[model samples]
Target: MASRYHEVYQSWKHDPLGFWKTAAEEIDWVSTGEKVFDPDQGQYGRWYPDWECNTCYNCLDRHVEHGRPGQPALIYDSPITGRTASYTYSELLEEVEAMACVLADHGLVKGDRAIIYMPMIPQAVMAMLACARLGVIHSVVFGGFAANELATRIDDATPKSIIAASCGLEPGRVIAYKPLIDQAIDIARHKPDSCLVFQREELAADLKPGRDHDLGALQAEAVVAGRRIAPVPVKATDPLYILYTSGTTGQPKGVVRDNGGHMVALKWSMKYLYDIQPGEVFWAASDVGWVVGHSYICYAPLLHGCTTVVFEGKPVGTPDAGTFWRVISDHNVVSLFTAPTAFRAIRKEDPAGAFIQQYDLSQFRSLFLAGERADPETVNWAIDQLQVPVIDHWWQTETGWCIVGNPVGLGLLPVKPGSPTVPMPGYDVQVLDDAGHPLGANTLGNIVVQLPLPPGSFPTLWNADKRFFDAYLAEFPGYYKTADAGVIDDDGYLSIMARTDDIINVAGHRLSTGGMEEVLATHPDVAECAVIGIADKLKGQLPCGFVVLKAGVDRSHEEIEKELIKLVRDKIGPVAAFKIAITVDRLPKTRSGKILRGTMRQIADGETWKMPATIDDPAILDEITEALKTHGISV
Candidate 1:
């Protein structure tokens, strides 16, 4: 279908405030704001600062009060636990109400901060909504993160309390999170006033006598007391949550989301961006800790009065590679959003896509991929298998939503295999050289968005306005530096290649490692691939390719490596200097599925690097180091 994207984008360009104000009317506001945007406020100005509303009310209570009381609001499917549960709007509202009462009972009130560190469970969703219900700012660190990292967030957010789980279930074993939480609290100077632990059947935690309390017991008590807490009214500018970007170190960088803009943007995204209708099943295959999980999995689907799926399992190994298809077929899902890495993993394991045929995906209309570059090979493979529009979109943790995406809701524009279509209505995306001047079409340069970044984007970092400005705004002066390198085609489609630093200098030429990986991924034997530029004193930097082969491939690694090397050289030309390609068991990634390219590069360069706290498996790094040595490529 031909898209009206041009007309819609022009409408936004013609009247930005008018467009947003119209979108804002869809939300139920306690009181409307006098101004759509107040440029005189915030580090970069604020949105709907004068308005009053409850985000929890919009996402939960309003839906129940309105016509969606009996409609499925959330579906919990955990393959690891062999558990499946569904909550209607009424039931979810009751749960959230009880959770709110629990929070209030714990001495929390409006403006208090709390940290939620838990697995991908229903309680995690309830806790977030409960915090929103009481207007307490919540910060969700990744579930089962290392002790020191959690401790850093504990110190930074300085929460009044901590909501955690006893354990997180993996494929083979259970990860006890209680010990990590204990160590984190012990390491941090600012101890929480209380701790609420949700006990899972797999492992029950030994709660500390004075500080810890069991979540089920408290929730049961709250339910029995017949206490009903109304959603607390908060200014639109009031923070809803503080999400620390993955891989925080000494000082945590928390991305703050305000209540009003968050609802306005996410609700709008559900209808217009994702093309999902209310009451329809929409699944974001992500953890509640990440931004995708926070927006799509927990908030957006519900805000739009749609049923959202909370999946407590991996893309594969939750039984087999077909778990995703099983869930979609069972739930009657309309759309599924997930990282490209997941498809890559599934493609690696089930190269023929045989498992996909095992399910009834008649209701599944589309697939959305993000969180990292969606290589063309994987995108095409999905399109071929699902016979659905495989959309590759781009956004950041700070933005909370998409900057560039093929708006499936807008009637998807022509799918460009390498590009994430065009900028959404809110963003004025530009490709700029180091000097801040906009580059011409197809020119590779740093990506930035014009000043007054659209609604739903972060106003400022939590308690660190200066750092926020310095990190995002200061570099480009009048632009929000995305810190990503990409090219905008003549039609304005964005091809995000890599981080700004990932643009490797080959002798005197700058090349994209992502471009090389795209070429390498086309190889039939290759399941997935990563290309990082290792330090080369002679050429300044050289592209190092790591390819993970598909299952049941008997081809020699040497032969596959040669083919991959040739493929990149032919596709990207000799200028890319793509010489080395190696086969590895797997690529090290974050828990969220982003390849640890920087760490891999650092190791290959023999540079001193600390272990990334967010690594999916630390042992993979050792495997990477051994792979590098076998190739006679650095340490």
Candidate 2:
């Protein structure tokens, strides 16, 4: 490990460009670089020049090139049924080939879309790799999504096929996944032509008879073919994956990240930020559907040619919340990354912290917190609890990976309670005001990038290229607006305050309320809706929706709540709709038709309801006040 880091550091200091060139050589490439750097037409100011490589070649085939094909790649566990699974690189390659062949045989050609709605099994990774092998753009929806939410994503992606399992474990219980797929397909406006289901014997929901293709059967057929599953040549700018963002606007945005840029950035980040050592186990408690998983759990570690852990079961449910610590102890993971929310929950559930103390965590060198704001309390608790340096970093779906971080004790600036650490190397960060001009240090403003987009920065939006430029680039010429408000302290550490938009952060992930409101507004009985994040003990903040019923609309509170909740689950995923509150009267608003969401937040917090002069309806304030009292909130 020392030799590897020393070699990289020496190379980086002696000749940075040469270091990149050598690093690039480590991966298998379909097209070698004609020039080390090629900035065609002055795109992003010469940083990323005409770089070329296939993503699959870098992520999967690169290991085989280094003669470590038989090394273990993914460690999976299903706690509900006491099933433990491991996949070696060779085994993974074969499964990837078989899955790719199955897709190709089912009319899934290059550029076709494939949706994977399954648990965190090894097959899920196989499915993703299979798509990459065949150049099929994959959209992986989290398995916890409801039927309606799954249907909406399927409608949006319009994939050629949908892959799922019959049952899977979540939070200790076995869940029926096929029923969700079947229900989603039944109502899907743009249903897939093929549905490949991995049937499990222990399932809660009944499976459909003939409409679904058996995954085992398909794999058997692929084994008989005996043909090599060669990867299709893909351009650097080709779409690698489409991950949806849960924005405040209630309308999810499909963030399209290019292959070459993301791969380069994530790889560099893993090697530098996590200090990944070869042969050392790395565990990141993040779902593959999330950007954390996309960057760290899959791309970064693989690109760096390091061993990684990918548990299929939930962190809390494998016999208790101690499962994570036990796994780390069992696997001897050197670097661990997870949400601060999970750590807090574990702390609350495990008073003795026995599981954490029982493990010899001396091997664990680095710990990172994300997925929601980690308040000072949680950060200090984690550092003391884990007895290791805890690095709380911040980034978003748009940024792709950690843009702000406190390096593993090296070059680490000051520690701020709720701060997002410092910017990474090669990044130029600034806090910009409404005029788009840079603000002085310690001033609050929207966090923006002063220089050209970074390596991990997504170049375009999915089906909304113009909108992408308008939202991120046009508003601030030559700068990318992050839409998040934060302050950079004197020591240069960034403290993320809040989003500039109506988006709510539950745990650490952003959820757009506008998207949920769009679904509610679609219902004839709904007149207006407002959603905001109320402070919570567990999740940092949870979305609390306040809706106004249409005139003469008759609906019970439970019925309306159920229906509106259903609407969100159908429109987005279940993870985005766990909290919804509705009021019968019109929401307090400004004359410009803007909902006074801050006022609502105050009401939810049980503070004295003070109507800002910007509010349009003063009487509506009284109604909201009365409603707050009903919920045991004092005003």
Report model 1's TM-score to 2 decimal places.
0.99
Per-residue lDDT of model 2, residues 486-518, tens digit only: 778777778775567556667776665644554
User: Which residue segments of model 1 deviate by more than 4 Å?
Assistant: 248-250
Candidate 1 lDDT over residue span 1-635, tens digit each = 77878889999999999999999998999999679998889887889979999999999888888899999999999999899999999988888899889889889999999999999999999999999999999999888899999998999999999999999999999999999999999999899999999898999999889899998888977777876999999999999999998752356689999999989999889988899999899999999999999999999999999999999998899899999999999999999999999999999889899999999999899999999999999999999999999999999999999999988878888998989989998899999999999899999999999978888899999989899999999889889999999999988889999998789999999999888888888898988989999988899999999999999999899998898888887888889888999899999999999999989999999988888888899999999999999999869
Instruction: Determine which window of 10 residues in candidate 2 has minimal summed lDDT.
Output: 1-10
Taken over the whole model, the C-alpha lDDT of each candidate is 0.92, 0.70
Residue-level error in angstroms, candidate 1, position 524: 0.8
TM-score of each: 0.99, 0.76
CA shift at 367, candidate 1, in angstroms?
A: 0.5
| Clashing residue pairs for model 1 | none
